[model samples]
Target: MRLLLIEDSAELAKWLAKALQGSGYAVDMAHDGQDADHLLFTQTYDAVILDLELPSMDGLTVLRRLRARGSTVPVMVLTARGELSDRVAGLNLGADDYLAKPFELSELEARLHALIRRAHGVSAPLITLGPLSYESVGRTFTLGGATLALRPKEHAVLEVLLLRGGKAISKEKLFEKVFSVDATTGQDVVEIYIHRLRKQLHNSGVSIITLRGLGYLLEAT
Candidate 1:
């Protein structure tokens, strides 16, 4: 999944971003609240990790703006403020979860997984679509009870498609989620991954359909 992390601490942000990427998530960083707010309106992210203290805008103000705009993207507040009042304010302002500073990476990841699952209306880690089953936390895909091996990019592509099944996702949107914004690769690379996935799942009961002018969709055979 794709996540936006709004953190002003340079060292902390870099460390978290790298850890998130290693865990199979495409992450974007914003050092200031204003930039994070702008990106929230312009781009789509599965969830957001926000810190309260910011340069251009405070995290609470950003959160308020986000809710005022009627955006329900899951948000997890991560900050050094561990006070009960701070946590309550964040939750009241539409934050999905809260994580204190000096927290374990494992706990942060677990909270993110919970947020994603709740957002998707999935209470269980194993997400099933037809004969395909995906373990969200493990980042493993199983088809017909057998493991399905895929390259990292290919796996990322399939994960997004499956999460948004039935909707036709534009190639540009897919590229944003699968590849970094600064990636040197061309958009055509998305098609290449799609082609490979189609071939890989040929005998499976799943199908990836191109929508011509639209983009691609995942459907059951």
Candidate 2:
């Protein structure tokens, strides 16, 4: 999935961005609230990780303005402030989850998975279609009770399709979610990954259908 990470700490932002990318997410980083706000206005993301302390505009203001504009993107507040009031403020301001600094990366990833799932209106960690199953925590796919091995980009493409199962997703949207904003690769790379995933999922009781102008759809056969 694509995620926006709004943080002021350069070192922490770099570290977290590397970690999140390693975990298979296409992440965009904004070191301050204003930059983050600008990106939020211009781009689309599956979720956001926001820090309460920020340069220029505060994180709460960013959240407030984001909501004021009727954007329902899932947001999780990650900050050093652990006070009850801070938590309440962020939650009230529309943050879906809160994690204080000195946190575990695993916990943060888990929370992100939960937030994305909820945003997609899915409640379970395991999503299944026919004999294919996806486990969100491990980010693994299984077919016919056996593990389905996939390259990183292939896994990313399939995951997005599975998350939005039965719905048509444009090639442009898949490109955005599978590649970071700074990626040097062209949009045609999405077709390559989609082609690879099709081979991997062949005869798995599900298929990725190309819809001409409408893009791709994952559906049970």
Candidate 3:
């Protein structure tokens, strides 16, 4: 999934972005609230990690404006402000989750996964379709009880398909979710990954089907 990380701390942002990318997420970073807000206005993300302290605009204001615009994208507040009032204010402003600073990366990742899953209406950590099973915690896929090895991009494409299984997803939308805004790759790269995934899923009682103009959907055969 793609995430917009709105943080003012350059060092922390760098560290967080790197860690998130390593965990199979495509991350876009904004060091200030103004830039972050602009990105939010123009782009779509599976979720956002926002810091309350920001330049030009506070995180709450950005969040309020986002909600006012009727966007339901999930937001997780990650800030040093851990007071009860602060938490209440963020929740009231539409933040979906909250994590204080000096926190463990593992906890942050776990919370992020939960938030995304809930947003997609998936309550369990394991997502299964036919012989294909995906363990969201470890970000691993298995077929017929055996590990299905995949390259990073291939894994990313499969994740999106599995998360929205049975629903047709446009190639453009898949590309957006699988690649960061800064990536120089063309949209056709999505086809490459899709092709790879098709080969990997061959004869597994599951298939990735293309619908001429509609896009692609994963289904059990």
Candidate 4:
């Protein structure tokens, strides 16, 4: 999954970004609300981890603007304030989840996974189709009693496809979920990665079909 992190604290932002990246997510960092707004408005993100205290525009303004623009992307508020009123205010502002500072990274990761899955309409942690099983935590793809390690982006893209069970996913959406920044260097870039993944899956005798004008899908037969 790809996520945008809007936080002002340099040290905490760095730590959170590194930890999130380690957990198989592509993360884009914004130190203030303006950059975060630019990213949120222009690019695609599966979920956003927004800090309530920001330098320029404040995270609440960013959240309000995003929600006002009819963007339904999931957002989780990360704040130092643990007061009940703060939490309630964040929820009222459309935050899907809230996390107080000094919390464990593992819990944040779990919340991130939950928000992403919920936004995508998946109620379960495990995603499987046909003979294939996807381990989200391990970032492993299993087929026919064998497991293959996938690069983070490859794993993210494939997870979306497999979750849909052979349904075509648009290339734009693929780029959104796979890359945290710069989704459109060119459509051909997406094609390149998709081609590599297709070859790899086919070699394993798992079919990955491209629906020419639409996008790519996994159809193992």
Task: Please tell me which model should have the higher TM-score, number 3 or number 4.
Answer: 3
Tens digits of per-residue lDDT, candidate 4, 74-98, equal: 9999999899998998899899999
lDDT for 169 in candidate 2 is: 95
Evaluate residue 164 in candidate 4 and report its C-alpha lDDT on the 0 to 100 scale.
Answer: 70
**Residue 221 lDDT in candidate 4:** 71
Q: In candidate 3, which residue pairs get closer than 3 Å at backbone N, Cα or C atoms, i.e. clash?
A: none
> Mind giving the per-residue lDDT tens digits that candidate 3 earns over 92-191?
9999999999999999999998888888889888999999999888778999999999887788788898899588999999999989999999999998
Give per-residue lDDT, candidate 4, residue 152.
Answer: 63
Q: Candidate 4: where is the Cα deviation over 4 Å? A: 136-140, 182-187, 203-205
Tell me the lDDT of model 3 at 51.
Answer: 97
- Models sorted by lDDT, best on top: 3, 2, 1, 4
Model 1 pairs in collision: none
Task: Score candidate 1 by TM-score against the native.
Answer: 0.91
Candidate 3 vs candidate 4, lDDT winner: 3
RMSD of each: 1.8, 1.1, 1.1, 2.3
- Residue-wise lDDT of candidate 2 within 65-136, one digit each (tens)? 999999999999999999999999999988899999899999999989999988998888899988889998
Predict model 2's lDDT versus the native. 0.91
What's the TM-score of every candidate structure? 0.91, 0.97, 0.96, 0.88
Structure candidate 4, residue pairs in collision: none
